[model samples]
Target: MAEDNPKSSVMKAGVDDAKWYWLAEGWAPGGHIREVDFDAQMRGIDPLFEGIKIVDCDTHFTEPADLWTSHAPAGMKDKMPHVRRIDGADQWFVGDKHFGSIGGNVIAKDRNKLLGRLAFQNYDQIDPGSYLVAPRLAQMDAMGVWAQICFQNGGVTQVGSLLGLGDEPLAVAITEIYNDACKERMDASGGRINGMGTLPYWDKDLMNQEMRRIADMGLKGITLPDRPERVDSSSAYVGPDGKVSPFWAEVFEICNDQGIPLNYHLNASLDANSAIWDNLGFDQKLPIHALLHHVGCAATLSNFMVSGILDTYPKLKIGLIESGMGWVPFWLEAMEHQLDEFRTRENRGLKLRPKEYFKQHFWVSYWFEDYAPKHMLEEIGVDRVMFETDYPHPTSLYPGVQDKLVETLGQHDYATRKRVLQDNAAELYNLEI
Candidate 1:
């Protein structure tokens, strides 16, 4: 009778016998593992803003490894970017050159473990929310954010990497594939996410085509390299000639006419490298390098302000993304002082000071910054400043972000706080909110 009782025998087999069953059911000793419902969690929490919606001007989205190859045309499939293991680590390769590892692009969850390390070297080590739109939306809800303007992950989004292929057709095709993928994510996000499209900025014809393509896809803006010369070494936008090229002027005109803003993100230029810090002591390099990253966007802004581009296309909107606001007051003061001293001598054509143009045609985003708003808001004006979380990045405001924002922004009057948290970005991006 005992031998015939198979069910009883199985129950008597003990913990070891039940291990596979528990694992299959996603069960742990304490409880069953399950996906968190962020939307549900958000319902119990009070609103951060009384009545205004919060719009994050700068957030990031990681592109999956298959984003290009999976969507590539048959002729271009062989040339599309794909991942391969090199020295036991997964690396992104376009043709022969290795771009970077998958790990650095999705560092949100593994940030603690990656304090001094380069990257996690595998997809499994990253947070799913970093690469998936649905998960990202949930994460946004959990953080009390309503909508975000998404930029591509640097490791994969490099215009320099795309141009290094030395294949114009391939580069343009890859960019289109990336834009299409971004548009797909935006479409799926139900107005909660907007993607800034990437362009093959080296070619004027291609840039024009891609800009129109992005607009058709309903994207709000286009991202240009922080250093234009880094994208194309011979780019007319820069050089010792010190004159704005007709090509770039035309491009600006297109953006102005199309109502698309040009977004310049920190380190968007691929020129800077850790190799420059080799001369410094190892202990001092990282900290010093991190300190200087904020200057890139400012440098880009100065270039446009002095180039007379702003004067030419007064209607064109430009945003400096992920660079904090603390440096702006000093930087603008210096620019104004220089313009006053040199405008007549150099025959620099400008009607207003650098700071004036900044307040009118330019916008800057801040995250993890408390001092800038306190000190510079009066000078910079509340309308030109926007807020961002840089979500899913290592330094991102997460978990308690709403509390953090409230603490930082609580002192301002409600209308002023509303502009910083929501209205500025809404108007700049032409967001429905």
Candidate 2:
């Protein structure tokens, strides 16, 4: 919006709130708020180029405080985290750490001193300004992200971790607040950035109400936990009389009837007690999630397939976000192996291979994991896999993400590259631009 100087243009995203830089104060690695030199970023180091187009499949925004304080029915807000005074503003405190504040753990943590060597710290010379893009076009120019589907912060709106909220009703309220905040953010973006809403996992009545609201608000889709603890309805747990958990049937029906897609985002943890604590051992925090993501997806998907949900609702589409591609081949093989064993039976309503349902009814998004094996394209099917820069997170490839991918899988030819970076996501999200 100014001269060629990227500094003057650093924070202004066409307008005052156009860019939502969650890591501005240094949540991301290699970030030092006091020393951020936008001009230097464009001039000396990695310059923000204008040609690359990135659709950041994963990004984040601080969830609104009112989501818990106002939306939580009755005394439930008291159980959830309350806004604490920090740096002259009320902020949410989870596990006794402040969020949505300039001085919070994620925003201002010492990136260089972590126990596990972080990628951002490793690439310390890179500047945060070089990664700045808030206005859709500016974002496109900054990180080459043509589009971004963002998530919500604060513990309650923090996906599967909602189990910490203690009950279904409060969890539903937290989700409602998250959706409302997302609607406002999407409106502010003027459709340039699509916002993903959180779902009310427990109560069917509330879930349906919010689903309808999300549709009317023009949001792209809703992100819910893979486990049943955070979700209500009949599917909260495995039991014959479990509140008619087929509620997902209703959700699927709504999405199908309304032409909306449902995104299943992995949360911090499946166990509520352990999710809030960060010091649950390196193995607990990182390695466990690594294993659980695949296990969770496989389990839920298998259940959905065998429970006759897919057969009952063939038109519904589900997105498996942030789960890596390595599991694709193994899981597909396992499912088909089972189907091969069962196909000759008469009551088998399913007529296609397990892989067919995946190709037809589901989508998978991959983080820029360097070891994306050579035959990954053949294993996961290039058209169904989308590339994502999990920006600001530990795994994010911001500042130099695309180049990393190019280095990893660039030799695969133009078609493979295009499919991994652009075409796949465009098709998955139904993006016209």
Candidate 3:
């Protein structure tokens, strides 16, 4: 953490968190916890989900500041991803180059602040569960969730920035440490928290090696760059005229053969960083960014639907993480309609329709949408859908996950609810729960 982001006393026994910095007026996590009652909330939701171990297929683990530097050798320690307080914001840096602020926080002491909490001025103000494995599991337990597939929250492995530094070793170290940290967090969580792997995607050889390593280490899946050619226009994956060549074939094959799902979290890639307008205020841009992020996932789905990747590697599973499922039916309809109208040479070669491809290979996760869960689960394919709570991020389904569960999934039959909330993800990630 940065100098100003003081270390938390959360692990300190009986420390009285209500008196803690920036926690609520009477905040105590295990006790009263101000006005919060997770047990009561889960009790309300229990009949529908009594025996089910709900799988939150998409949540984020905010990386601790030492995630990289602690593992780096002494000489390279200062150069690995480390935080420094810059302009009153805790920003990550690699050898004085600014990565970005660790800006995913919008929770405090297990409380959701969508209406009251505006911004996290420093790391200390954020929830401990955001970065800690034990607390994350506790958070899941409190919310009536059994397991979570976690992604890197803070955009630390965007890779383009690491590649731009022209230091391949540093880039590799950053990626390796992130992947290593993913495995570490998974192990520490007793498999309740499965962190997805990342890759130094500009290099195909390195990417292939890391995928194998991830599979061997039992990391559930990997998040890919939607366009790896954009990482380095001169890399081997970059063909003539800066077009992407047959670079992603091995990735698809490995994922298909190994049964490793390719998760697209729709963050720091797929045009997500550019989704928000420059003029909007921080809070104003927050929601607009997330809404547009779902649109990016829609584009990703459309691309894969027509790209022939699914047809070629028919068994590969795709996860649209943190992407709500309400828009998918309409998007697929629009795509099928366009395919019918355009009948181009390329469109003629696409063996399956967009919706067919989606049903065959892709899986999506939804959070905080009532109509979709209640009325449209069948439309979204309950077998291919899962639940998530986004967890501590802005716009996350925090402080009311059980409420949301009861409101959205409560009406469904037991089997349907089990599939959406647990079985799909358990089969996908092979989580024991």
Candidate 4:
């Protein structure tokens, strides 16, 4: 059984993909696209960014249905994730269990904004740029973006469902297919987009081999589960131990040795704030959950700050993707206070305080934020902060990426602006452009 969350809990009726699928009825408060001069924006770079190539650190790449099947080894094709039109929505499935939807794509093929609870419902409705390489490159130029770090939409990398299917060989194959496709996309786009890779997180042997493979293959980074206990199981990863596993630290050491960044895109865990959803209806709860999910990284990252993992692997670079930067200062302050109040730092034998570790080991991306950009960029460390437009996803800084870049970031001095908007990402991802 799949995790029945708001995104994938659509009433299940139909099963099987289509020669072409019909669109599902959209959610309430959806499809309100702002009127913008689409043609002009697409013509060329925005003058405000006349000389800089902005890097959007966080964007979700909608995986094509054939992403795995077409690329699969002849024997493994049927076992990979395939899209089935269920109740009019395109849902991913493996064997019999459900995976997840083609997550929150708010951009329409016709270029209308379909945000908030509103969704495209199927591949027929999304922009080609959201998935295809050529259009993605063109849009990057139009939006004055140099490169983007993309994650898979719905596949093995997605938490829970894919791994819960409980087959290790199938999971490894699924992860490799996505990573291989990312390399192809990177080469095809001339390095304009770098899709982060995922490992078979449930197994240490597979995780070790895959991490090394991606590094040798020149993959920029790999998305890891911040909560390892939930992922590693007796059938694959390990039994009994969860978060406290020494194996987790060993994986970090491999990443550090390979100079591979460890990326933990916001996962569904440790969110003290999501409890507010118990009272609201799905549509009402959706937006708040999206916001809370981003802030939830505060818990994930802060936990690592004291985990002594980074203290062991000091050179390991970690990224908290799609988690906005607004809550960082307050969260760091809160963390430091607890460390001081309880004297945990002295006991932990910490080399530095929580803030120091955050700056040293972690990097974060932001979209649709003002206070952090307007006031807190300095506090967050310009070198550690990067720009993001969740691009195409609801709440992504879509349509107005160029306008917003100029609006929020234009006032800063050129060096600072370039660092936040472009250089930090280039440094983090080893992006050539």
Candidate 5:
């Protein structure tokens, strides 16, 4: 009777038509929808980052396996950095010691796949952009990054490890080779990438000569290992006597005079005790080790703060690279508190409190951080904070860097965002863009 009725027939037809409509819309009976094209969706422009310039203060690149070998002086060819097949993998050899492997240097592409592994053994496995300047610029453009401050990968440590094993000529030659390669890349980048020169911290005369050479090369800054001793124990720049060693003072003065900031990257200190952590097993050791990575940087800063270095050279600018600014607030506060409780004219080399010196002389970089910028802006000061990507490293903000920055600094006004993202770094490094 219902089927025969005209009204009932019309209602049944409408319901049946709705089923076909939903099917065409890609919805199923279980409320499932067809797969989405996320990549295509991401192609849509993000209004938040529109027209915003981003200057990445920290990024790393792998040196070509032949960097030292190709550039070493004719007489120093035998002492150059080279790759040797050890067991089944490629190991980087510098003067008789196995410094590192080429594998883990460029992990940006297969990071998820090689999550727990330390280094990648060969160039075939790495992203070309990791070592090649042209491709790296293209990658930066795709990510909306305006510029980068580039640092060496394991090559710095490798040069350091060669210490006593090689003669001064070989050591200086190796340093020159690496610096030339960096300069060549920077020259090729059309101002988008600025290479920080590495100092031959072992010999005072060589270090001075290289510093002058780096300044002549028009490099923006110089990279100081968090622990110079890690590279060569006898040549440790900072020790029981403090960072005021004639070598350090001269280096600082040269940087200040040349207008190049002294840049300190994290994890330069490799403690002998770190080997003991292996007994804790990978799972337990990994997290704890990561937690302690910044300790050396803090110690380095403490030494500088108390040594009157900042007070001695007012124009000297120091950039703390790859070390997040989150810890800075508490670190400075603790330093200030200690200064207040224990201030003696003899021991207190600093005319100002640690925090005051920090505010005046230091620029700190932050990446993969959200809460620090928002909450500690006043303590850290917006002017002293700079943004970094730590690109191509394990902790880099690569594909979705814009989104992460927006999420972190969006709540602030455009001026603050602009300063943190670009203006501060530009001013610090004297970058045009």
Candidate 6:
């Protein structure tokens, strides 16, 4: 008998490419859209897969440009990207130049049709109908991905930038709207598609309300940016117990109480490596693109450990999404060294080893590369590593993801491969389907 998760027998019941598939709740679309030429684009990555099962953990889509103006309150709508139809019912562009810049900056376009048109603009045009979910699914079916965990793209826009938006009330409203939309549109798709909720990192009360609302809506996890706008990694504030930053305390309490795992979706912009490009004064894209996700991944794990968050909440299970595993072993080792060398007044009360606490408390998603050291299992523990396809994005191997996993773990026993691909995620997400 075949497995239960994919439910291949009922194609429409789970996820199929026949119709338009919206991956994330908020609008942030870009990367390998189907209406474009895929054959030439996929040639580079497809060679890796002869036979494999694929599961995508991170992928994104642009939001409908007019979301804020349509769904937001009247006072706030004026502040959103202004939209007006031009040539036909489907044609429109951002009207307010200033706010339009925000929308355009977010999606790189004003009109959805133009956006759709641009999805194919880079390559020879292919009919959107010709290839999309069907080929994508065919690839997955070939590879044997039981399921995937999809996250929002546009949702990450302005999470930290909201600091510059000038109104606390409006910022909180934006966060609530985006999150509620995630639950309604993304998670509601049921099994094949899994959605992550966003939190208001700046406001503690709003964070409390949003967590409750997301849990009630059945979202499995929440996504926080690698760099929060206002809070520094080293800053400490007293909590309800008159300790530092109750936000984390409340986060743990809410997640533990409600069974939601907190996911840190790594972005590619916050690393100091990108600063090298900045000092030379060229576009930051070179280093920004290179170091973004990996560095953020390293920083997030490092921050939680060095700042005593892991020791503070031993039971918390944090998921570092879209961050590949190559850097983790080194980062953890560095933390272990720091713990030993800096056993000074600043580190007085900490009780446990940083690496021990991290392995017990956190999980990371690996994609594209899996050349981890043999001692990785001994250091971070294999149970803490999971798999991701990053589907449809330029980096995604889609059809061949499992082939990579099998190849990487060829020396290992069957059980290890199975756990990394399926069992680990099943336990991490608490996926019943």
* lDDT tens per residue, model 5, 1-433: 0113232211121112211211111111112122323253223225676666789899888777788888878777787878886654555666566565553343434322233444444566556777888878866876678789988765434443546444667767877878888788877887888888888776677788888898888888888866554333434444346546576767878777766888877753545245444466544554555557566577778777877667778888888887788999889888888877777324755587777878878888888778898788877899999988776665466557667777888888888888888888888887777
Per-residue alpha-carbon lDDT of candidate 2 for residues 235-312, written as tens digits (9 for 90 to 100)? 442334422256565677777776577677653333433443666753355555555755666666665565555666
Angstrom error of the Cα, residue 202, model 6: value is: 2.5
| Candidate 1, 1-433: lDDT as tens digits | 0122232211121112111211121111122122333344334223557676788888877678788899998788988888886555556678776666553332434322233333344566656777788877877766678889988763555665666667878878888988898788877987778888888777777887887788878887888866555434445463446566655765677788777898987742322344355566533554454456677788888878877777777788998898888888889889888877876325865667787788878889888888887667878889999988876554565445676677778778888888998899888888887
**lDDT winner among the candidates?**
4
Number of clashing residue pairs in every model? 0, 10, 0, 1, 5, 16
Return the lDDT, model 1, position 184.
87
Off by over 4 Å in 5: 1-45, 85-88, 106-113, 156-160, 229-243, 270-278, 344-346
Ranking by lDDT: 4, 3, 1, 5, 2, 6
Q: Which should have the higher lDDT, number 3 or number 6? A: 3
Report the Cα lDDT for residue 341, model 2: 78
Look at candidate 1 and give me any clashing residue pairs. Answer: none
Give the Cα error of residue 34 in candidate 5, in Å: 22
Per-residue CA lDDT of model 4 for 1-433, tens digit only, reads: 2232333212221222211121233422345666556776554556766677788888888888888899988798888888898766777778777666766677778776774455677788778888888888887877778888898665435545545656767777888888999999988888888998887665667767887788878988888765554433332112233233555555677678766787877755554343674766655766666667676677778777776666778888888898888888889999999999988888777778989999888898877887788788899898989888878676777676877777788788888888888888888887776
How much is 414 displaced in model 5, in angstroms? Answer: 1.3
lDDT of each: 0.68, 0.53, 0.71, 0.73, 0.68, 0.52
Worst lDDT 10-window in candidate 2: 9-18
* Local accuracy of candidate 6 as per-residue lDDT tens digits, 267-308: 443534434654542233433554565786777776666565
Candidate 1 similarity to native, TM-score: 0.82
Q: What TM-score, to 2 decimals, does candidate 3 have?
A: 0.84
RMSD of 4: 5.5
